[model samples]
Target: MRLQTGANNQDKEEIKKIAEWILTVGEGTAEGNNDGATEIEIPNDVLIKSEKNHVKSIVSAIFPSIVEHLNDKGYFEDKAILVPTNEEVDSINEYVLSKIKADEHTHFSSDSVCQSEFIDEFEQALYAPEILNGFKVSGIPNHKLVLKEGVPVMLLRNIDQSNGLCNGTRLRITRLGKHVIEAEVISGNNIGYKTYIPRMKLIPSDKRIPFRFHRRQFPLVVYFAMTINKSQGQSLSTVGLYLQRPVFTHGQLYVAISRVKSKKGLKVLICDKDGKPKNTTTNVVYKEVLQKMKEDTTF
Candidate 1:
């Protein structure tokens, strides 16, 4: 944010050469009239590494030895690896989970296709338990949620309001029980707050799927890494921008880079089609949306 203008004097000329991408670093791209915001070089203060293996680079630089220091609030707090897609997020989380030298706890969800005209007994028969278990719908936990104690997860539903348990609320796993999970809130108004989460019936609102199904499972998702769009309201002190694929949506790159408190705390690794790291990546911006927003805010 301090370097929004991209202005540098002769004294700082040498430092300016280090930046390769002109990033519009500020309060996450929404605070001001960013009608046509553009940039070329990101400042050299942050660690910008170009590695072929982005997940490996991300883990090594951002969340190294996560199991050893899971109790450390600083380890998980205000620090995250940012990616382009939920698939990447899941893979990164699984990779991190695979490294933990602890007992594994796999929670299986009871998935059933709701009785409806859209799906009959024969169709339902096709959606076997194992087949339904393989389905990963948006905005719900997976059929087989494998977790370990001391892992971090985000609440997918508003379990409790007064207790600060809501959607997007982060929690650190304390005890992975057979029925319930014991976790402490690690972010928002409930930091260090202890609570229990029970299995709940969750139904996805994806209307495209003709048959409605309900998944009974813990309303949680691993928070080791999240998609760029999910990181909008989040403020992290240190962020590793893992561009496994370049962002496709409007302002995604802006939103991704702006998650960190400062450019100094941000690290970016841009990758090409072959997963080779590069210096520059695409930044999609909708000028019409920005212009409309500016017009709306004018009054």
Candidate 2:
């Protein structure tokens, strides 16, 4: 049985465009003038998306060789942005922080002030700290902020969409502060532009929790390695896709591979049963979804 994944309105629009493109191109029809025939120009966004997918496929094919070359040049760990599963984010972050002595620079402790009109002081004492500490241990905005200048970070909220300070936006910390931080946009159109990020109150949606609790913290995380879901919609100069376990969802492998700007910046490391480096990986694609897209052109 095939699972149905819901597509957003934008996705449906893109599908319609692709279907029309396919129908127009596959039928071998061209708009003709009196003197000559003119071929349809593909949309710039479509061309860029196609080019990125092509580069990703090529990079995935030669990932091992790319990893070897990167290691030889001593550019794997320090420079490249590592993308891994959520389970591995903490371990990798800890390893990278320790290697760089991130603690020596500056540490910003998140102010976890309990703010709720419903809960009293005694009740707040029981759930607020416990829940907030749990979030910290689980790497939700992190407990202790050990930041070093020039380290990569991922924005946790959509602070400014116009300036490209959105969720999952990658940046390098330029200056640390008590109430704010100066960071330069490392990816997207706003690259090299510096912006200020301030600590804000963030509330988690956990249905199991009986009381409401909000944690005041900077909406940023040390992104030495991030989850594939969080790495979506952002392209990196270099990507190291470290697979401790095989990806279990559709489009995850595709998302991870397509994060790099070029084939030269991509590397994949798969771990075997013994947790050693393996050369092969399993890629899961729901073929039925593609078939559905081809069958349904009404979008």
Taken over the whole model, the C-alpha lDDT of each candidate is 0.75, 0.57
Q: Find the candidate with the highest TM-score and give its number.
A: 1
Per-residue lDDT of model 1, residues 54-140, tens digit only: 677778788767767977765686778888877888899999898888789999999987765476578868977788788887789
Query: After superposition, which runs of candidate 2 have C-alpha atoms over 4 Å from their true positions?
Result: 1-84, 101-126, 136-140, 205-211, 292-297
TM-score of each: 0.84, 0.63
What does the lDDT read for residue 262 in candidate 2? 42
What would you estimate as the lDDT of candidate 1? 0.75
Query: Candidate 1 vs. truth: CA RMSD?
Result: 5.2
Per-residue error (Å), model 1, residue 35? 10
Clashes per candidate, residues 3 or more apart or on different chains: 6, 0
Candidate 2, 144-242: lDDT as tens digits = 667766567888889899998988777877778878989888666787788999888776565665555566778888776778877766655567666
Best by lDDT: 1
